[model samples]
Target chain A: GQQVQQSPASLVLQEGENAELQCNFSSTATRLQWFYQRPGGSLVSLLSNPSGTKHTGRLTSTTVTKERRGSLHISSSQITDSGTYLCAMERSSSFSKLVFGQGTSLSVVP
Target chain B: SVLLYQKPNRDICQSGTSLKIQCVADSQVVSMFWYQQFQEQSLMLMATANEGSEATYESGFTKDKFPISRPNLTFSTLTVNNARPGDSSIYFCSSSLGGETLYFGSGTRLTVL
Candidate 1:
């Protein structure tokens, strides 16, 4: 079975501070996606990056396929950013099936 | 991106009763996936549904316990048989359209007593 590991299980940051989240996979993945879930809410896709670096607004995702690792960076974090960030990977053989990491909980304070 | 609409945003049922959750995709998709999430936990893959075919369940999930149907490409259903208190959890419906990114529904929160 494939496994995804997320670092910094939880993080707290002051508003305007920067946050960095890490994700590592146990096996080769064909696809990697980042998701944000608010308390008692559904997951919202943040970024989908299997390799290289991608940016959307103040959020950036970088993935190194050969190393089986990925990272998400948030600049000037805001209070609305408080939530759980999850990383999911789809193995090369599994097609659309995704294996999720434990997730990194982020709390931003003013 | 496909938008998934799930019915019965929340449900409360007595033990031993059966529960069914419906998921409808706005556009046609190749497959639909069902995932379970416990309180403060990550998502767990339950099964994969394809049109006109029997769903492929993951380990520890049985067809008798959780039966899935994909009669068409735009619709699917999941039924939990003989529900128990332990069955209380959030169930999410998701699908991807020929890409890596997946779109998810709001999810159904089930509480069994």
Candidate 2:
């Protein structure tokens, strides 16, 4: 069984629209990070949201430690935002060893 | 800022052949991780590399199939031995300095035929 799971395997949104991606973990996470991966490319760090809410530009991430859930909100989606979003978390006792989710593939259309 | 770089962006190898992927970090890091992704799918952890000791491989992965060496704090190498079609995938090397965020390299795309 996967420790971290992402919702809405795929999403399609129009430009200027807002979209939310969800991540649920079966175990408690001491650290959580969000990443974006373009088609045929590497994964890039988007936000490090261990707990509470964090906002940067038009992207916001909220993580609920107790509930073992995390959410990433994208506002005014752009074409460049079309990619796969992944959520990864690490256990408290681990030395930053991360377990990744399946990821949500999002496409922003004009 | 921590940056990781991988060598041989892409390569095509014959079956049973071997290939080596290198990961270098801009600064000294404690640990590095190797991951494999197939067809833009979910990433699977292959192994964890640390300086001055043998690499730790995850279940379903063997040191004989994928040998990892951490010569120093800032450099590591992963070698895929006796490659097969199943070995084809994009390999990424990542490291976290002091934070939980793992910074990944550009990744090496391997095609085994």
Candidate 3:
């Protein structure tokens, strides 16, 4: 079974609109992290939320440990925000071994 | 954040040939791991390259086919032996500074003909 699952396989938004991405994982996951991959294939770490809600600029990450789910909220979307948003779950005792979701492809247009 | 540089950003090779991809981290990191992602697919962890020890491979991956060598904290090399078309994919090397946040490399695009 897949360790991590993301919803809304794809999303389209206009500039200045908001976007939300969801992620669900198994109970075995110790931590959850969000990443953005450039069209060229480079990955950038967005945020890591274990529980509660976190805010970063126009981005917000909320994680519910009890339900084993998390969500990323992007406010005021911009053209440069168009890319693949990925959620990863960290497992294992040592090292940050991650299991990734299929990802949500987001396209922001003017 | 640690910056990772992968050699030969992209490569194409014939079937049955072998190739190696190297990862170098700007700063020393505690752990470095390898991941494989097919076109339009999620990234899958392949193995954990440990310094001065054999890499720990995940299920469906073997050291014989994808051998990894981590000689030091900031350097690791992954070699693909007996390459096949199915082996073509983007390979990423990631590192962590003993924290939950894991940084990734730009990735090496491989094409096996």
Candidate 4:
């Protein structure tokens, strides 16, 4: 069984629309990070915030540790934002491996 | 932030044969990990490459099947012995600075036929 799960397995939006991706974890998490999977199967780190609201460019991540859930907001989306977004959680912050969610596929159209 | 470089972006091998994938970090990192992902699936952690010591294996993974070697802080290798078609997947080498963000290599796409 997967320890982490993501919502909206797939999503489609207009170029200017915003998207809200959700994540839920079954175990205690000391760190939460968002990543974008490249077309070639590589991954690019977007944001890493264990809790509270953190913003970087067009991406914002908010993790509620007590609730065991998190959300990612993408504002003013662009076509280039089309890809699979994954949310991963680490049981501990000190050099621990991450358990990843299934991922949210975002397709931004013009 | 640390940058990782993986050699042989892609590899195609025959069944019963073996191959080695290498990962090098631009800067020294305390830990490195190997991950495997089937097509359209999420990534799964394989093992931890410990510097100056034998690698640690995760569940369903063993050192005999995927021998990992980390001679130093910046370099590590994962070798697949007697590969099979079922072993085909994308292998990623990753490292972190002991905190927030994790860095990943471009990844090695392995196909066994």
Error of 1 at A72 (Å): 0.4
Model 1: per-residue Cα lDDT over A1-110, one tens digit each: 78999989999999999999999999988878899999899999999887999999999999999999999999999999999999999875344568999899999999
lDDT of 3 by residue, A31-78 (tens): 778999977688888998778999888999998877989999999999
Provide interface RMSD per model, one decimal: 1.4, 1.8, 1.3, 1.3
In terms of lDDT, the best-performing candidate is 1
lDDT of 4 by residue, B20-68 (tens): 9999999999899999988877888899887999998878999999999
Question: Measured with DockQ on alpha carbons, how good is candidate 4?
Answer: 0.75
On residues A52-98, what C-alpha lDDT tens digit does candidate 4 reach at each position?
99999999999998899999999999999999999998887654568
Grade the docking of candidate 2: medium
Candidate 1 lDDT, B7-112, residue by residue in tens: 8899999999999999999999988999999888889999999999999998888899999999999999999999999999999999888765788999999999
lDDT of 2 by residue, A1-110 (tens): 54899998999999999999999999878867899999888888899877899998999999998999999999999999999999888775454357889899999999
**Per-model B-chain TM-score:** 0.98, 0.97, 0.98, 0.98
- Clash totals for all candidate models: 0, 0, 0, 0
Question: Model 3 in CAPRI terms: which quality?
Answer: medium
- Measured by TM-score, how close is model 4 to the native structure? 0.97
Model 2 misplaced regions, further than 4 Å: A93-96
**In model 3, which regions exceed 4 Å deviation?**
A93-95
- Least well predicted 10-residue stretch by lDDT in candidate 3 chain A: A89-98
> Measured by C-alpha RMSD in angstroms, how accurate is candidate 2?
1.4
Q: Each candidate's lDDT (Cα)?
A: 0.92, 0.90, 0.90, 0.91
Residue pairs whose backbone atoms clash in candidate 2? none
DockQ of each: 0.74, 0.66, 0.78, 0.75
